[model samples]
Target: MSSTLIPPSCGRAIAVRAGGLVEVVDVEGSQVGDLWAIDVADPRRWLSTSHTRDTLEQLFPRVGQSFVDQRYQPILELVADTSPGLHDMLFPACNPALYAREGSPQHPNCADNFVAAAGQAGVTLPAVPDPVNLFQNSAPDADGRIAVHAAITRPGDRVRLRALRDITLVLTACAVDFWPTNGERCTSLRLDQLDGDGN
Candidate 1:
């Protein structure tokens, strides 16, 4: 296992061998990285933010805490961790409709990206649900509506995912024009296998 840096504006299919570690770094500050993790043996059983958050709140992951799936399987171990304190669990992937709303007159959407990727991989699905927003922030307002705010993440911040089962992880750095207050642009990400000392 070697460390690979995925530059901004590109997508990659990362495989996390059972018990292997996957760490996503936000190389540029305040950018959002959309992530989805699927069971390799059964892609249907992917990572769920609702389930993950529920578990995290209950267990309170500290340094070296393990992220467990709904079935109580350890998906990723948190060898290295950092802020925003929590991740956004409610932002769904941008669909065709969203594209019509936010995309430029000729550009594609996030759903298209997922569909293209899935098609290339030969995995089929009815609909793509909300994915985990790794570095974005959505805070509930006084009236209880969620508001998209500037990212709480800074450069070099990361979340580590360890495989609970054989899994396929799908990720796309958000291409949305309106994001992170400053602006939304491609992010440079690096994925590295944990060293023996766990740095």
Candidate 2:
């Protein structure tokens, strides 16, 4: 198994072979991480949150379920999750524009982090899609009001994912300090790229 640590307000991209597992660890409680992936074989058919939601007919991710692409192709599988399972797929990745709207024009965000991570992975895309906000606590009420709150993930909690195809994985240590998204503070994350089976 290989591991990488993503510091607070930073991002990193890695290649996950088919059948390989990527483990994301909540080093400290109340931290959120953005997870995005694109298939190397077909870039145009990247991971689609809408498709996944429709496929599962659910909003939140579940263990033993695969996150699919726009073409309904499996990309990554949520093999295990130890957190509170309150991740969000409805919200877009945090970006500078979002911060600017909130009165913080120069705040660091996940959109820029994805670009940097993609560059390091030697891959490019036409647009940045909404990522799976790991450890995030977002709930929608009966009236359709979504409230974002502090994460419930405890220290050392982990979420494991399995790659269903050759793909590039990008992760960002969410830097949203202006809200309770990161408990009003940013923190580091740990990513472990585990070998397949006996390899």
Candidate 3:
């Protein structure tokens, strides 16, 4: 297996063939990573959180469940999770506007990092898609109030996913330090492109 280190507050895009696997490693504890997948056959097609939610009728990802693309086609599968199993598909990737609204401006954000990294990978899209927030701990309460909290993932925790199609995977080590997200401290992540039968 080959690994890619996603430095703190940075992002990277990698291409993986169908049936290939990628392991998202939380190199440090209490960190969040925003993840996206783009179909190589059609760059315009992407992993759609909304579509996946509609298909699965669930908000959080589950092991053995497949995530679909914009067209409702399975593009990725959550094969394993070693964390608290709190991955979220309810929020958008942190952006510049989000930081500015929170009294901070020009902060390193996952949205920008994703765009830059995707560009370097020669993949462009009409708009930024909502990412699956890995290791995120925010969930709706009894009254339906969603309060974001810090991730509880321990160091070396990881989620392993498999590609159902030729695609480019984008991952950003979340940069949200102002709120409880990321435990108010940013950290690094790792992407391990594993060979066959990694399970």
Candidate 4:
């Protein structure tokens, strides 16, 4: 197992070897970390939020449990469980259009992070797909309105990933100025590898 700390409002790219585990810790409460997983070799077939959410629904993760994406297969396990609240199943990674819609004139969005990470790994691609928003909550209302709210994760909460293939994990601690106190500005995080025993 290996461990590293990511400072608040920053991003980190991690490469996970085949059969290895990657654990993301939300050291500070209310921090939002945008996450994306890509096969180091293929780079195209990356983490799918729809697939992940379906797996989570099947496993029924409860409070204090961890979700596992085994063999990149359809069935994910709830090795350790945690409570579910306003988890977003359809939200995609931030893109230029999204930024523009949100009234931000920023060129670099979450897609930029993925592209940058891939470039750093010597991979080239025209575009990266949508990514998963970990520790963030966006709920939709009956009239089809999306409401962004504070994160439901508390300090020390974490999400664990078990690699099904040799993959790269790209993450950016979001620093949305509108939500200054969400812990993204100066949050702390710890990453650790899991043993075969799933501990």
Candidate 5:
């Protein structure tokens, strides 16, 4: 197994072979990580939040749930989720526009991170899709308004994903300090790529 440490307020892209397992660890409590997966041979066919939500018919996926792309093809499966299940799919990845809208014009964000990570992997596209906000605390209220809260994850809390196909997984340690989505402080994370035998 190989492990990679993503520095705080940064992003990274990892190539996971088929049948391999990728584990994302929250090095510290209260940090959120934005996750995305792209088909290695076809970058356009990437993880789709809308399609996943439509296929599952649920806002948040459960353990053992498979995440699909825009074509409804399975990409990665959520083998395990140890957090309190407070993730968010409604909120788009944090970007410069979002920061400007929030009255912060020059803040680092996940959108840039996605681009940087993908670029590092030699894939450059005009735009990246919205990501699955892992470890984030947000849910719709009774009136359907999304309520953001602090993360419930403790240090060492993590989630495991199984790759169904050759894919590049991108992650950003979401640098959103303006909101409680990241507990108002961002932290680093760890990613481990394990073989089928859990090596």
Candidate 6:
């Protein structure tokens, strides 16, 4: 397997064929990563977290479930998870406006990261879609309040996913530093392209 390192607050885009296995690794742990997938054959069909949640009838997908696209087509399937099994799909990717409101204008956020990465890959996004917040620790409480917390993933924790179709996968190491998110410290991540059928 070959590994690609994503420095703190940075992003990357990789091409994956159908049935390809990609593993996302938290190199230092407690760092959140925003993830998105766009169809290579049809860039219009991008991974929709809301669609996946609706199709799975759950807040987040299980290991065997697949994340669907806006058209309700499966995009990527969760193959394995070595983390604490904590992820969030209800939140939108962080953007400049959000950071600006937090008094941190021009901060590098996941939304911008996706745009730049996808642009470099020659795929134009229709919009900044909600991402699968990998390693994020946020969920609605009984009172319907979604509170963000630090990720519980330890060093080297990872989640492996399989592409159901040709895709352009984008990922970003979260950049939040003033909040409990990412343990108030930005960190790096890694993406490993493993050979074979990921069995």
lDDT tens digits, residue span 1-199, model 5 = 8988888878999999888899898998888899999999888889899999999999977998999999999999999878777788888888889889988888888999999999999877768798999988887889987888988899999999999999999988988886777787888988889887766
In the order shown, the candidates' Cα RMSDs to the true structure are 3.2, 1.4, 0.9, 4.2, 1.2, 1.0
Identify the runs in model 5 with alpha carbons over 4 angstroms from their true place: none
**Which wins on TM-score, candidate 2 or candidate 3?**
3
Query: What lDDT tens digits, residue by residue, belong to model 3 across residues 82-184?
Result: 9988888989999999999987888999999999999999998888899999999988999999899999999999999999999999999999987888998
Name the lDDT value of residue 103 in candidate 1: 47
Q: What is the C-alpha lDDT of each candidate?
A: 0.65, 0.89, 0.93, 0.61, 0.88, 0.93
TM-score of each model, in listed order: 0.79, 0.96, 0.98, 0.74, 0.96, 0.98
Residue ranges of candidate 4 with Cα displaced over 4 Å: 50-78, 81-86, 96-108, 180-186
User: Ten residues in a row with the worst lDDT in model 1?
Assistant: 177-186
Candidate 4: Cα lDDT at 184: 34
* Clash list (residue pairs), candidate 5: none
lDDT digits (tens) for residues 152-197 of candidate 1: 6788888877766777666666666555521455566666666544
Candidate 4 lDDT over residue span 121-181, tens digit each: 6666556655556666776678988777777677788766666667777776665545533
Q: What is the lDDT, from 0 to 100, of the residue 14 in candidate 2?
A: 92
What does candidate 3 score on TM? 0.98
lDDT per residue as tens, model 6, 155-190: 999999999999999999998988898999999999
Give a tens-digit lDDT track for model 2, residues 41-144: 87777788999999999996689998999988889999999887889899999888898999888888999999999988888888899899998898788999
Q: Backbone collision count in every prediction?
A: 2, 0, 0, 10, 0, 0
Candidate that would win on lDDT:
3
After superposition, the stretches of candidate 6 with alpha carbons farther than 4 Å from their true spots are: 197-199
